[model samples]
Target: MLTEKQVVELLETIYDPFLKKTFKETGAIQEVKINKEKGLVSVKIALAKTGTAEQLQVQQTVVQRLKDAGASSVGLRFAQLPFEEERTTNEPIYLAIASGKGGVGKSTVSVNLAVSLARLGKKVGLIDADIYGFSVPDMMGITERPVVRGEKIIPVERFGVKVISMGFFVEDNSPVIWRGPMLGKMLKNFFDEVEWGELDYLLLDLPPGTGDVALDVHTMLPTSKEIIVTTPHPTAAFVAARAGAMAVRTNHEVVGVIENMSYFESKTTGEKEYIFGKGGGQKLAEELQTDLLGQLPLGQPDWNDEDFAPSIYGEDHPIGKVYMDIAKKIIAKLR
Candidate 1:
């Protein structure tokens, strides 16, 4: 016959989801009551939620552990954990990559930054709020639709990060010409219906320009921040600034700036070429009073290819290195 001490030792094997440790380590399993005369063992396993899959798995595991520990009869009881109130804060620091024009590589920068942040182990989620121009699904190479569990919409995981985009719903190159209210409903559904889980950063790949889409996103996610992307040129900066100004109007913070296709490095010459001219990023940063977050050179080799996702970074590529550096800078700023 198994003693109470052995039962306690076996209960220690269960994993605790939140603490990411053993049940005994997390105090998830409280005291064990043993009735040797009746050949019965009753275990009280503290639960963090009412009906989570985790809780069900925990119970199942408890039964296995109890039997394995030599219990003739076992009874499991669950004690519900008190729910903690969510702390409301206005500063969620949602960084949006946006521009007043398309073909500015806004989505490219956003996807890379989100991936970079994930590589640094920060809880990150990327939303292709661009709706019509939802390049994120293609960029991230995620084809799976979100899993719906009751009221919860589990986000799609790609590159170790949660991502939601319209590209999953629409066909390839299909135009999404939906109007404001309809698009607003979908955007809000993504926010209210989808469970983003806990995230340190949520990078929004917004639609190009200060359109109705931006207005809707600002309404849904007011705590979001904005990151304007432009080329190292005057016209792009002006248009990109307009997008940033729109963010300010919507009460979202414009955190920083990113300049893409700012320059190119010649392989043979080993020299940096200011292909898009200079000072545009610094100029835009100064105009917006935000840091110049990053400057990306023209990526030739990592461009659209059949081998990999279009916006994904090729390992050992220089542009890929720049993304890693930018992600570190973002972490430092957040810290």
Candidate 2:
């Protein structure tokens, strides 16, 4: 059986997730009781907010630590902190890349924008919030999975960007069969459970269309800014306007519109062909009352076997330069 002093010392290392401080620093461990003969321990904790996912995480940590310290069982109780402490941690700018429909290269745009921002020396993180159709990990050529450190999941870093995706959790390219509530819970975990160190921008690659997951993100990050992606086709642009409207309804500032696959350029003749039609990007931007950020030409990235990412474009590639300019515009608008 452990003594009360021993229990207190052991719990001092546990952190209050929201406060980002240890139990000792916050004095959150209000009471500790130890039943010596039965080796049972009970502790009462105080946190900035109770009954949250963070609180549940803290409870699990407390219980596990007590058991490891020779307690047969652990009982935990939580209460809201009496006084709110000013949070000193800097929150990252939340940006969501969305589209009104699928097959518009929304994920491709998302992956490159994150890489472009990182290339510009901005600390960036990307979340594959398109839960049902997660492709970010493979798109970025991230082969490794996130590792658990204490109570937090450390995001995988690639190209100066920290990334978390549902693809890392599933095996053998299996399908996710979860419902809405479960998907929302997993998305919340991406925010609450992942350790994204100081990030200038945190971008969410939302599922195309105004659906449940998108709605959940709008609800969760009330101040998130959104960018609508569309092709130059009239139909694609017409559908994309609905996504912009959804962002407007949620009070998310529509940063700008990006027209992807606007045209195709010939390698031999150096001639440009308006393959998908023209002016759709401008039309959507006008509808959303925002700027037309850029029109991307249809082109494939020059692949490097050494560091091969299927969707990412190099900084010098023509399309890559377009993305860089778009990234700069985004930084300017948001900052």
Candidate 3:
């Protein structure tokens, strides 16, 4: 069992996310209770803000730290502190990669664009906002999970990009059965509680269509710029326009459109095969009143068992160069 004084000392190291001050400095640890017989510790804390994702992070940290310090159980309560102006941090340029329907390679576009920007020496962070269809972690070959330090969840870094995904939280590829409100809360937590550090760009890989998760992201990031993904097929591009329309409705700038699986290039004859048809990308771009970012062909990345990122393209790969060009266009447009 731990003493009340010991608990206080432990908690003093934790800081209030909004206030940016330790519990000791802020005098935010209102009460501490310890039960020796039960080896239980209970604490009541106040922060500059409550009922936020930051509060939940602080609660988790307190519970985990007490348990690690030999407490069998821990309980925490939170209240809002007296008024103080919350500190502000530099916000990154928000970019959301969305598609009207799945199987159009939206996630593929997102991962590649994020990696390409990172390759250009830009600080980038990726949020796998497709809670129900999260795949960024596996696509980026990330084998590690984010760790909690103090009160913030540190994002996992790979290919020079920092990333957080719903895939990390679920076990054994379990389906996320959460409702809309719950999913929205988790998305908010990703933005508010994750320690993204300094980032030039933060990319969101949204779920397909105008779903709840997509709506939540639009509401959360009103200033975000979006890139719609579609196929060269006319129907695919037509459906993709709906996503672009939603972005427009939410006041998000439609930066461009990317037509994926545009064509396959034969290795033997080096001929271009328009498998998904053509001109859909230009039509969509024209309708959206934005530039055609790039067209990606149907192809697989050269697999390397050693590094082993199934969906990522090497910088020197032909398709990878196309992504780099699109990334450069994005930088120029956004800047």
Candidate 4:
């Protein structure tokens, strides 16, 4: 025979796999009934969403743990909490990466940043919200299109990060010639139709400049923050400032600036050549009142034929280490 307090102590050790919190912390164990004579124990629990594999796992674990704790039989049942409560408790942080112009390695930085964050044990999703100029799929080497599960689009997972891109929908690299309203609608669909299951972060790779798609993203994600990307070129930094300004105007926090291709490093000599000139990233960060998160050197990544992503480096690679450091700083800033 176990006391109610001891039963709760046992239940506290059981964690909800999806929420990553113990049952006691989640207020999941609503009721616990025990019958010592019959060796029966019953628990009523609350779940954020019902009938998912995670919920089923939680139930199974609960029953097994209780049985192991001395109950001959355990009865379990679940009631779903309000939808609003669930969403409010588990909303993901949305971060958009932007540049004032193209050819600054914005998409590359976006892919690697998302991947790096995922490597750091955070659930991450990357949206190629570049719309007409979408290149996340190409840079990521993603060829498979997203799958439609019922009404929701399942984002393709690669390198431990979930990804959705317009490239998956285009035909033969044909241009997306939709008007502004159509573009907005498509961007809306990416958010509304895609089934991103409880991400820790959602990174939007916005098209360079304050274009239709960029504006749409600003409007769609009013609470979203931004990371500005630029090269070390003076002209490039000047243009990137405009993107940072737009983020400010839209009330999005400028988390930091990443200056890509800041230099080229010689492998044998171990010397850094400032091919693009220097100080652009620092200048932009100063102007935006944010940190210069990182300066990425120029070096083509080694590709594997079997891999589906480009510009991806392992955590130990030089560029990969830079991105991981940036990811850590970004996480700290967000916190």
For residues 1-335, could you state the per-residue lDDT of candidate 1 as single tens digits?
77767887777756554333456654666767888898899988765554676678778878887787678888988875444311222123577778878888998899888988888888888888988778788777766788787445788988877898877777667888887788888886676566676688888888899887888778766777788888998888888888888887778877788899998888899799997788888898898888998899997546554446777886468888888988898778766
**Candidate 2, which ten residues in sequence have the lowest lDDT sum?**
82-91
How do the predictions measure up, each by TM-score? 0.71, 0.84, 0.78, 0.75
In the predicted model 4, the residue pairs found to clash are 140-309
lDDT of 3 at 16: 78
What lDDT does the true structure give each of the candidates? 0.78, 0.92, 0.91, 0.87
User: Which candidate leads the pack in TM-score?
Assistant: 2
Ranked by TM-score, top first: 2, 3, 4, 1
Q: What does the lDDT read for residue 1 in candidate 1? A: 72
| TM match of model 2 to true structure | 0.84
Better of 1 and 2 by TM-score: 2
Best by lDDT: 2
Q: Cα lDDT for residue 238, model 3?
A: 89
Ranking by lDDT: 2, 3, 4, 1
Which residue segments of model 1 deviate by more than 4 Å?
Answer: 1-84, 88-93, 301-307
Better of 2 and 4 by TM-score: 2
Model 4 lDDT tens row, 1-335: 77778778888756555454456767877888888898988888887778887788777877787778788998888998666646666668999999999999999999999999999999999999988888888887887889997547899998889999889998999898888899898887788678787789999999999988889888878999999999999999999999999999989999999999999999999999999899999999999999999999998777788874577877888889999999999999999
Residue 224 local lDDT, model 3: 91
TM-score of 4: 0.75
User: Worst lDDT window (10 residues) for model 3?
Assistant: 82-91
